[model samples]
Target chain A: MTIGLYAPGASALHRLPAGVKLGALVAASLALFAIPSTIVALAAVPVAFAVYLSTGLGLNRLILELRGPALLLCFVFVFHALAGSVEEGIAAVARFAALILLASAVTLTTPVSEMAALVERLLGPLEPLGVNPAKVGLAIALAIRFVPMIAEEYRQIREAQAARGLDRNLLALVVPLIIRTLKAADDLADAIEARGIET
Target chain B: MTRDVSTRDIVYIALFAALMAAVNLVPPIQVAFLPVPITAATLAVMLAGCLIGAKRGGLAILLFVLLVALGLPLLAGGRGGLSVFFGPTAGFILSWPVGAYVTGWLTEKNWPRMNAVWFFIFSVIGGIGVVYLIGIPWLALVAKLSLFDAAKGSLIFVPGDLVKAIAAAAIAETVRRAYPLMQAAR
Candidate 1:
């Protein structure tokens, strides 16, 4: 199963090299803060949405991406309004919201594998520093692989806790979760060892 | 314990990193008017350190952070990517690996006499003290709020974090008695 936010499309955004898009993202983020004009910062939000929309992702998809940060954006506005720095608040919110939109755009358009490859390549230069880029990439893939398993374990443990009278106790919930996480890790380790995938 | 990261160590790191992602799916407690909600994901940071040794624990969290930056919706409330780096709580988010590292380092140092109290103390020191050390200043700078103002909003997370520290401490002691995962790495 496809585990991430990647939504396939043939749009220019989708066809754009993952590394270039990521580089643009990093550059744009730096520029957002480096520029002092709040208006310029706020203006970038629409541009980000435009890029997002160009991916054939639609306005609804773009708006949905904003839902999580929307609350925070509102709070940011209100906090700054109270502090008598509404313009500053708007700038901060705008910068973050735009970045969020752009990020989602990148993730949705780019396949996880492509992104992983980009990361590995980016880390390649650090190999001399003893950073094993391939291992790091594999670890990331393995971590993603483990997510569904861990979520299942979390659910089972929560259910088990509820079955007893210990549902409300934090320790009851936490202790077994930790134990099971370790157990799962141990089993996976033994499997990897048996497979002789040299570290 | 050898300097080389064995296959077991890699799996442990990956699993804990996965644990971070999975924990983010837990329902977050939204404090009205507060941008960042209280989350179990942060508790997982403590668990990463308290369960795994320093090196792997820290690396586990570092791995998670890299994935988050890579645009995975691995954070609570489904927030991730470069967007989070620009957000007000970016400081706290970035501090996860450091916090985990400190917690694990302290845990390792006190392993011989490990108990709930030591676990709690280390978790608090690393998870709370170290995290907010970076998080608060970042919040203030990014949000253009005064230190006092930034802290006022951030203090809300403290009560919940303390509770998580307690849970981590309890789990730490229980794991030590029942199954010490860190021992294998050592």
Candidate 2:
């Protein structure tokens, strides 16, 4: 459950530019959907797994990333079976699973900063249309920084709820969490302004 | 629009994006009788728009989605990366920014009044209506399920999502009264 985790490695995939990795992902996704052959789709799954292994992150890491999506994959498969298109079900699951694995491989290897830079570069042409690549970069940096802070804040909220013996339902926790988040945002925004940071 | 993005606005946007991440990571709540646990991640998306208003709300969500694509495990249960975009719920996930935009746009219309009823309706329109509009097609056309089948499959989540929409409305009402953002919300 790590965010923007870049597993350092000297593999070929790791050395590839973030833009290329993303571009290839788009192309690969398109091909997966466009080709109707179940065989090719099924074949792609293992190929994706092999590439994931090449990252040297181990089988456990690949499984860890795919754990969330695999349940949905199982659902789609069941849906297809119920609809009497078991073949399509297998193909659909294979297609998605392959894509997830391949993408995780690319993301696991690429640095978050590199990916942010790629987005800024991609948005470079839009500067004339009033897009600020610099601001986008800044926002990305700030979000990355805030992720852990927000997580910590949630921990405190949970602790407070437990102390009060409040029912730890979504509603009970979310309201207080939102209030505090906005409060933090207010102070952080002021601190940023006081520091004289440009937009 | 770009020129108006001050450092303060950027911080709000970034923090909401972080809020989405934080909510996604929070353990899904298990209502005793429900068959499955409900997640607050999507609820956070709804709350983002209602609390921050349209422009910042929309940008906050878009920024969060982009970070997920950058391979951060910021999604629920620590899921992240470009792989998420290829899932069955990809359409719903991708539609979040627009959903937040619509929700924020509606919530800001009667600003300072804190009308919980109207706020609830607006949240439903943006959170449920807009999301289903985009998500259904992704499942029906791209994923090769029948429109009815896809729609039927999605019905299971509607009740829970409605609850989140209601929560968003109530939260907006409370925040307006308690904190007030201390400025023109929009």
Candidate 3:
């Protein structure tokens, strides 16, 4: 859930401009769509993982990070196989895995601060369109920061609900979470205003 | 009221984002009639808007997308990355912020206190329309189907999405009443 990239060392990949890394990801993604060989896409998985490891990022951490999606991929593959050809289904699954790993590498190398700065710079042209680059940058940064926080809060809420015997019911868990989140948002607004971030 | 962002506010934003991501980790609700799985993540997105208003709600979703893009399994069925954005379900992913914005905008405009009819209209036209507008075209492009076919496939989602929207409105209004601070934020 943590959206912040975590690269282990200061390396060339880490030093690269966020825009360049983002561009690389885009180009790689487009190229991935072009190549239909499921085998080649499957091969890219190890290569991407190698890249992550070579950069000093831990393999264990990466696997742990991928566990949730990996499980989801399994379900999708099963569903796809049931619905379509096994060959096509496996191919689709490989493609998805390859894309995720590659994208993760980019994120792992780039810091959130640099990402925000890059986004602001990219939006410079939008100033003429009446857009505020700083605001956009701040929004993106906060979003990145929020990913993990929301996840943790959900865990606590779920536990609380479970203890109260409400975990079995979907509405019981969801309603309280929503209410808590709304309350948090109001507090955030007050904080933002008080900080004079709006001004 | 005119003070800087407290540490608590920062914590709240972080908490909301994380919760949104966690919900994505849950198994999607399987629908017997459709290929698309029903997930509560959309409800979380709507909640973000209702609580944080348009700007931060949009920010929260953007964060969620970034996490997915970064290879976190923080999506329905635990899917993530740019590839997901190009798949059949991509449209729904993209429509998230727009849905949140619509929900927040409607709430801001006094729809929160209205009768069920207006509430239904506000939630549907605003929340569902935003999602469909982005989702339908993307589904068409990915599936290599005609617009009508794509629309038809997506139609299967309408009933479920409507349910989520109403749930969102009800939750939003209830919170607004329970915690006066929510309404006072605006």
Rank ordering of all candidates by lDDT, starting from the highest? 2, 1, 3
Q: Residues A50-75, candidate 1, lDDT per residue (tens digit)?
A: 88788887777666667777876776
What is the C-alpha lDDT profile of model 3 across A1-199, one tens digit per residue?
2443355468677777878878987776677667777787678777766766666677776775577657546654665555556775576667667666766666677665666577678878877776666655554556555545655676777678779976555556566766666566566767777887663
Cα lDDT of candidate 1 equals 0.79
* Sequence-dependent TM-score of model 3: 0.65
Query: Which has the greatest TM-score?
Result: 2
Q: All predictions: root-mean-square deviation over Cα?
A: 3.5, 2.6, 6.6
Better of 2 and 3 by DockQ: 2
On the 0 to 100 scale, the lDDT of residue A9 in model 1 is 85
Looking at model 1 chain B, report the run of 10 residues with the lowest lDDT sum: B29-38
Ten contiguous residues minimizing lDDT sum, candidate 2 chain A: A166-175
DockQ of each: 0.47, 0.60, 0.21
Task: Order the numbered candidates by TM-score, best leading.
Answer: 2, 1, 3
Collision pairs in model 2: A4-B72
Q: What lDDT tens digits, residue by residue, belong to model 1 across residues B1-186?
A: 123777788888888888778767655434332345535566777878888978898899988987777667777757666567766678998898899989999988878888999999999988999999999988888777788877888898798788778877877888789886657768
Native A-B interface contacts kept, per candidate: 0.53, 0.66, 0.18
List model 2 lDDT by residue over A75-185, tens digit each: 778778889999998988899888888888888899888988999899899999999999999899888888888878887887787788764555556677777888888
Give the C-alpha miss distance for residue A117 in model 2, angstroms.
2.0
